[model samples]
Target: MILYGGNVVKKAALWYILIICLRVSAKNGVTQDQVSSRTNTLFDDVDDTQKQLDNEVRERLAQPKTVWVIHIPTRFPVLQLEDLSVTEPTFINTALVRSRREYQLGNPELEDPIISNNTTPCENVEEESSSEEGNVCDSDRTESEKPSEPEKCEEQEEKPGDDWTFDTQHKWHENFPDCAGQSQSPVDLPIAGLIKTRGARKLLFVNYNEIPNNLTLIYNGRNVILTGNWPRDRTPAVYGGAAHSRRYLFHSLVVYWPSEHTIATLHYPMETQALHVSAEYGSFEEAVANSPKDPLAFLGVVNIYKFDSETQAGLRTIINSAQKCKKWSVSMKPMPLSVFSPPFKEYVCYQGSLPIPPCTESVLWMIRRRSLTVNRESSLAFHSMLLGDDPPQKVFIRVAQALNDRHIYFFR
Candidate 1:
């Protein structure tokens, strides 16, 4: 029978009832009805093999896989440089010098004689220079001394995130290769954010939004100067749009580190006989160290490094090391489609860009086998931290866009 057909549960319940009644009739003195008569008429022609085939198809119908199609850009513009290395001028130097000039004019207190050429006369100098030659010295230098060109700062090139946007002509298709025509952004490059593959496993991506970006917290006594306001979009938050801010979900990533396995076993929840997160009777590392060698079951504790603004570049610089390792993997437990579904009850389908930029149209939308729970209290606490109470609470994430004709991959 088709798995989604109406009354399937009712039919299943009725069959159970019939079996119970048949047993009771046999125990009592009543002449029992034939098994076929009690349990809705059985098909004489359908054999065990045919029944098994139907069951297999029904199981397949219930779950589907998910795919992420990435798009790339074409024709990047060449950034102009003010200074170059190899004893040449480069763009970074030009930008830095310009930045220094603007900053000096904007903050008078920070202006130093070394930077401004001591042009701002001291009140005491006026008392001494009150004589004729002093007056001549001030007047002659006023016009003759060329305005000390704003002291040029040793220029450094601004990084990509601070100044670049993706090209517009390229677009993604639901299928492969078509999306491949569009080049991947620096962040989208498999090797850019994470390291390239080392041996056999895949490294997962992490976005640390909980840590604050305040410079004081990062640089307590450092000599380095920090620039630019940190972008809020990078932090997971409900941006106002088609989806209410409240609807968004937050996820964290962890690195995979494995240990030697000692036993062979099937993974399961102790009571339900289903796949669920296991409690660490011992520490998580101890569990991993002792558990059998199922690639999927190797769970261990990883130190979550705090990622704030000052530390971001240092981490990105070392990303290549993480990539050099043999294995890095992403978490792919099936999340409910309804959780990603739109707010309206009637609209069965729709589609849109990936919230992340280069917002490509490569999602093969599938909900979930089961809905994940988000209690009201937990959601509210999360939202209050991001949006603040200025506006009343609202659903935050975008509803699931349409699947189009794209094939969905279900991990069974």
Candidate 2:
């Protein structure tokens, strides 16, 4: 048995941590009135501290809630069940980054900074300075506080990353000089007076009807890239339109909102650039490397579309899969080529570069003369996917580049 005077409780009762299974009771000789009087002041301090914390929580919960608020580590209003085994104390720490029992507690050397805060799967977390005063982590300080709210989803997006960015396309010449080249892409295809060519065969699309077993969809910060597994001999290929002789095989496709290659001044709802590289090249990189002057190296098939009253199954599959893609690449079930390469009786062909930066001016663009129609849900799905029920961001598209007297041709 241990005996301590009422003086000890008054000085640092809250500061001391008591072990479980240890019984703390009134002193054997001390009367009930003496114990109550001695501990009254200490209880008052604890009441004041706890009341302040409880009120703060209520006030915030009363505030209006957004559609979806992403928080770092975990959600706000963290609910924990009371543990009976522990001895009573004035405070408890519920905001630890890693739980000693659950996560093996200690962080490894040079741990990932993202998970360093708390190993909670972060979602839409604003990520303000962790050093803010009165954070909930300061539970022992006699004050209570909440974690920071997330910032706008747009703010969370990376700007001017190490590689090129869609945000800074105008200043791209500072990094990739080709972006400013004379024959840059995404120019206005004025269909009225384009040069006409007749009886062009070999607009052949081999293996387009067959779905590839291996496919991937990548969200690379700016745009989504869809890749298909092209078998060597039976790879999807396009021939004859602008390619005088060489066969162009499937490379990759990039998704864009507000069509890149506009028909006159009209900007359609969506456009997909299906990039194809010459079969002669061993790899897509080789084709890109030789693209500066080789027109036969790349072929860009442009599909422009808008919202219709009804949705197509292929289009719906893409939209659903895209929402799940999130930030990185995801393996996808095979989608038919019809979603990308709609049948075209006539196409307008032109010479230009890849639409975005490292804008190599070496593509033969085959654009369908008529626009296609798709469901509007694709647009809404992407908006929610990117911003969580928020309206979509304004079109951050590269305005049509100057044609610079380049000839636009019509092939039938």
Candidate 3:
């Protein structure tokens, strides 16, 4: 019994020592409360430091890199959707060149810099800087702040127009040598056929007419239905619209084919005022061409009165099928073609003077033809200009020329 009691007491002592050892091993000479408090303080400090670091990063990013920008003088600066890229940031750099010498961005030897912060006339600078000041400026300006009715007053005030000529220090043309004396017109042009020409050139229209021909003993395996007539003297057949020097004559003919394969011609630029006639029959083979600089080179099918993909696809499929067919008839109209429905294709009658310098008589016009089926809804949402809802409208076709009693032709 005594031995059993001794063993019990020894076990209890060993257990108490183990408990003390465990407690000592768990902490570095600190109480549980003290350790917890210190840990909380360290965590709070880390959190506050992290927040401050995050704020600093944000502030640095928010700051704008200020640079002085100038506009270089140009006769016509055409702005197109192609000029802007969603993936690219536009940073335009302007340089000032003089007859004496060309100066770049930095040259520190001079006392007064070329562009000073005070002289840099960026209109939005003040607003942006004030915004950067943030809540501090808001608090300071509280007493001085006045409720602004900008929306009400905006309509009444006349905003300054964006003048292209503004801040132009030295006009290049004014100082440069005049080349007007070197300009002269050519009497007769060299004829070209069956060869391609290169370099920048202008095409002035001479004449355009459609002449019908039957599917004769086939030429080059394809049925040649219409032959375009370019007069011997590639000038306008009839000049004026009146009897004395006004009334003009034009050849207008309709082509008939079996109902299967319809024919339609697409005039590109849709706005070419003048016809550039090459001595050659085909445009592609003509060496001296008068078409658009970069004419849409790809082949696309055109219906008489509308732009139909199904009809195009059907025709393409038929052509691919290699079937020997005898009969097909296609229809065409005299005036503007009419083969489209509402919304998808709209027809608006416009009466405007001819785009040419002479300003010929107005004609009845119908424009909408193609019902372009977009692949996705996101494709249509490109209207946002990085500003607001006022998306710009694109002009697919040029303004129609004034019809001066001229009969236009089509394939039926």
Most lDDT-accurate candidate: 2
Reference-based TM-score, model 3: 0.17
Candidate 1 structure, TM-score to reference: 0.18
Give residue 222's error in model 1 in angstroms. 29
Q: Please give the CA lDDT of all the candidate structures.
A: 0.23, 0.58, 0.23
User: lDDT tens digits, residues 132-156, model 2?
Assistant: 2211112222422221221211212
**Candidate 3 residues 85-189, lDDT tens each?**
112214322222222112211222322222222222221112211122211211233433421211210112222421212123123124322211121110011
Off by over 4 Å in 3: 1-53, 62-206, 209-218, 228-256, 260-282, 285-295, 298-412
RMSD of 3: 33.5
What stretches of model 1 exceed 4 Å from their correct place? 1-354, 361-368, 389-395, 407-411
Question: What ranking of all candidate models by TM-score puts the best one first?
Answer: 2, 1, 3
